[model samples]
Target: MQNLLSNLKITINEKLYVKDPETSELGRKILKNSIILIDEIGFESFTFKKLGEKIQSNESSIYRYFENKHKLLIYLSSWYWSWIEYNLVFATHNISDSLNKLCISIKIITQNIIDDKNTPHIDESILNRIIISDFSKTLLTKDVDTENKEGFFLVYKRVINRLIDMITEVNPKYPYAKSLASSIVQGALHQHYLKDHFKTITNLSDKDCLSDFYIHMIKKILS
Candidate 1:
C-alpha cells in the first residue's frame, strides 16, 4: 500500500504553480508542511516565511514552488479534488446499482478524514479541515476570472462532472443534475463549517452523521 501510494501522484494544474512541488524532496516538504501550517494557522495568517521557518527552508525557496500563498492554496485544493476523483472512480467503478454507487460517492465525499498509512506525509484529517474552511477563498478573489482561464479549477470541475454523470444515470429526467451535484459538494463544505462554528445551524452532530444526512437528502431529491 505504501508503494502504491508513493507511486500515486495526484497532479495539479501546471498553471497553479511556478515549480512542481511533487518533483523534489524539498518541494514535497513544502507541500506537506504547507498543509499543516495552513490548517494550524488559517490561510490569512499563513505565509511562505512561516512555512519556511517550520520546514527549515528559506522563503525564497518556497517561492520557487509557489508564487504566493493564494497559488499554493489553489494547488492544495486542486490536489484534494484530484484525490477525491481518483477515489470516486476506484470506489464506484464496478458497482452496478446506481443508487449504491451514489451512496458510496456520498460516503467518500462526506465522511470525516482518516489518515492512510500509505500516504504518511499527508494528514487528510487536517487537509479536510482546510478544505471545509478555506476552499471558498480560492475562488472568492478578484483573480478568479484569470485563474479560471488557466484551468486552475479543472480537477474540481471534473469531480463535480463525475458526480453529475452518476446523478443523471440514476435520474435521467432530473433537470438539476449539475446544480444538485454542486449543492452536494458545497453543502457538505458548509455543513462542516456550521458544525464547527454554528452548531445549531446544522444537525450534523458528528462527523459520522454527515454521510447519513447527505444520503438522505439525495434520496429525497431523487424520489
Candidate 2:
C-alpha cells in the first residue's frame, strides 16, 4: 500500500507556487521539512529563513519555489486535500452502499494519520497536525479573494464536492449536502483540536472516539 501511495501524484494549482516543488529535490525538501517545522513551532512563527536553515539551503532557494510562507501553507493544504480525496476514493470505490461509503469516508477523515513509508518525504502524521492547527489560516487572510480567483482552493473544493456527491447519493433530497459535508470535514478537524486543547468543551475526550462520534452524527443526520 505504501508503494502504491508513493506512486500517487497530486496536481496542485500552479498558481499556489512560483515553481513546481515536486519536480526538484530541494523543492521536495522544502515541503518535507516545512511540514515538520510548522508542526513543531506553529505557522505564525515559521519563516522561509527558518526553513532554509533547517534544510541547509539559502533562503533565496526557498523563495524560488514559494513566494512566501503563506503560499507554502496553501501548497501543503492543497497537497493534503488531494491525498485525502485519493484515499477517500480508494477506501469507498468498491462499496455499493452509500451509507457504508459515507461511514468509511468519515473514518478516513476522523482517524489518526499513520506515517506512510512509501512517501518518505511526506510525514502525513505531521501534515495532519498542520491541517488541524493551521488550515483555516490559508483562507482567513486578506489575499484569500485574490488567491481564490487564481484557483488556489481547487483541491479543497474538490474534497468538499466529492463528499457532497456521497451525501447526495445517500439522500438526494437533502437540502444541505454541501453544508453537512463541509461541517463533517472541518468539524472533525476542529473537534480534534478541541479535544487536545479544550477537552471540557468537546465530547471527543480521546482520539479513538472521534471516528465513532462523527460516524454516529452523520448517520443520525442522514437517517
Candidate 3:
C-alpha cells in the first residue's frame, strides 16, 4: 500500500487556493509548516501571518497560495478527504464480498490515522488531529452553501458516496443508505472528539474500540 501511494498526489480544489501549493519548494514548505502550526494552535487562532513566521516567509507570500485562512482550512479538509478516498478505494477494490468490503471501508474511515511515511510533505497523523478537532469549521460557516455550490466539499462528499454505494451493495433493500453512510463518517469524527474531550458521554475510550463500535452498529443496522 505504501508503494501504491508513494506517487499519489492528493488533489485539492483549485478554487481554494490562489496558487498550487504542491508545485514549488516554498509552496510545499507553506503546506508542510501550516499543518504543523495549525496543529500546534487551533484554527480559530491560526493565521497566515503566523504560518508565514513559522515558514520564515513573508506574509504576502502565504497569500500567494491561499486567499485567507478559511480557504486554507477548506483546502486542508479537501486534501484529507481525498487521501481517505484513495485509501478506501485501494483497500476495498479487490474484495468481492460486499459486507467484508463495507467492513474494511468502515475501518478505514473510522480508525485512528497514523503518519504515512510515503507522503513526506504532510504528516497525516497531525492532519487527522486537525480533521477531528477543526474540520467542522470548514463546513459550519455562512459561506458553506456558496462553497458547496463551488464544489469545495466534493472530495468529502465522494467519500460518503463511496460508503453509500457499499452500504447499498451489502443490503440492497436498505432504504436509508445515504443517511447511514453520512452518519457513519460524521459520527466517527464526533465519537473521536468525545473520546478525547467529553469522555463521560462516550463508551469509545479505546481508539481501536471506536472502529469496533461502529462496525457493530453498522452490522446491526444493515442486517
User: How close to the true structure is residue 134 of candidate 2, measured as C-alpha lDDT?
Assistant: 92
Which order, best to worst by lDDT?
A: 3, 2, 1
List the candidate 1 regions with Cα displacement exceeding 4 Å. 1-6
lDDT tens readout by residue for model 2, 1-223: 4455668988989887899999999988998999999998999999999998999999999989999888899999998888888888887878999999988988998888988776778899999999998999998989889889899988888888888999999989899999999998999889889978999888787446888987887788888
Q: What pairs collide in candidate 3?
A: none
Which candidate has the top score in lDDT? 3
Cα lDDT tens digits for candidate 3, 1-223:
7678887988888999999999999988988898999899888889988988888889999999999999988898898999999899899889999999999999999888999888888899999999999999988989899999999999999999999999999899999999999999999999989999998888887445877888898899989
Q: Local error of candidate 3 at 198, Å?
A: 0.7
Q: Sorted on TM-score, highest at the top, how do the candidates line up?
A: 3, 2, 1
Residue-level error in angstroms, candidate 2, position 182 = 0.4
Model 2 scores worst on lDDT over the 10 consecutive residues at 1-10
